[model samples]
Target: MSAADGSASAADGSVNALTSALWERRPQTSVRIVDAHAHVGPYSLFFIPDAGSDGMVRVMDRCGVSHAVISSHLAIQLDAAAGNAATAEVVGRAPDRFTGYLTVNPWQDPARELGMWGSDHRFGGIKLHPDLHDYPLTGGRYAPVWEFAQRTGCPVLTHTYDGSPYNDLPMVDEVAARYPDVAILAGHAGATPNGFDAAIEVARRRPGVVLEVCGSFNSGSDIARMVREVGADRVVYGSDFPFIDLRMSLGRVIFSGLTEEDRAAVLGGTMTRLLQWRSGRE
Candidate 1:
């Protein structure tokens, strides 16, 4: 067919009606998309206001994101107890759409708080920001938390990067080795360009260390490379929304050169499996 015949043309001046129809009818709806990392409360360090649950729900709907695993900025940047409480309340507001990750400081008795809130239906996992909280992942103080996670099959999402002062890849690797049963998410996959390879290396060596793609600048090719190296089962999609645009983070995976099954796993399936495993659904 030709443009002259009321059909679009390629550079070769050829076209197929069936190809056009199929392209027009391509699937518009998506499978369940989950943002595995997000913040709900204000960050005192950054001086930014909170992006409440309502704000996040609107963003999720706009991007066709079915669920988000969220933690509290207040917990990471300031008070762990209050932040966990706030996260629980927000997650409780929309149990179907949101899952809370109880943020805690290693120095504190995380187990005490974990005992109180760990079984709450609104909570799915734990979040630890060693860099922000200024605790080394290898420190003995964190051992109790690790033990608890391993025993309960709780996934821990930890802040990770190349040169962060506290818990970079090296420390994370050690922790992963120590707690083999605890599901660990490297929250940024080493959030910077230099950190990407390091994150991949750690994930490759440590079966428990799953890569979380959540930064604003993570490239599509980088995500695709992670899938190639570690398999889609070990990579989960996360937006780090409000801090970074949820759309931007989601776009990285959507446009990555991954097969349909791999892309689906990264976007939601991997996390879904992690959640189910944590909650004994697996």
Candidate 2:
């Protein structure tokens, strides 16, 4: 049986079970990985219990991943408050190695509750899984969450793509258009069944909106296309870790044929600046 956090699995049921082409490449990205889209440990990689918090830190160290942002899948499935609190606790053990993203309920008293969560130091920003949360990003009820983030100078990370508009893109784009400074991160980088075009469009149209390197990968040509269409600064590295391998995912970025500067930005520099901004808030 697989434990949620990716601990002690049998050779048959490894983390690589559902991995992709990059997983097969086992490409050596070599650069220090900054997993922007990973879920923290202790919540199992897939939201099962007993994933163990230490698993995150240990695996990160093993893979040369310098840092990661942990979001609670629990909040996505169950209690938002508990999810946020649990995610915070995981990051607390190794603050230097992990960044916490507070998972909030899009359907909850988003305005009042989100405003109230501003002081949680563990949270660098907000994470929204519109598809999983069952809320519309463009819906008026969600505006308060974006507005508050803009006011507080924090970014919001949301799942966005070609499909799942109600859960992902249109609303993300709408909210992003509303608050340019909020730094909305378009999760998945539109990386799935042919979403690159839309991901590219968002990068072109939205100045502060960036594509996160998560449950997504690009063909060599696709990677080149991404850079040509959106420019490299709009790109950021992320690993949907525990769910994927740091080495493999980082390899996708490192090998994606972008300029050295662009590679630096995507590898970790761009996010490094974002983290510095977050530090001032603390």
lDDT of each: 0.81, 0.68
Query: What CA RMSD would you report for each candidate?
Result: 6.2, 10.2
What residue pairs are clashing in model 1? none
Task: Give the winner by TM-score.
Answer: 1
**Model 2 worst lDDT window (10 residues):** 11-20
lDDT of 1 by residue, 184-275 (tens): 99999998887889989988999999999888557999999999999999999998877777877876777675766788799899999888
Off by over 4 Å in 2: 1-32, 41-50
Which candidate wins on lDDT?
Answer: 1
Model 1 segments beyond 4 Å from truth? Answer: 1-28, 47-50
Consecutive 10-residue window with the lowest summed lDDT within model 1: 11-20
In terms of lDDT, model 1 sits at 0.81
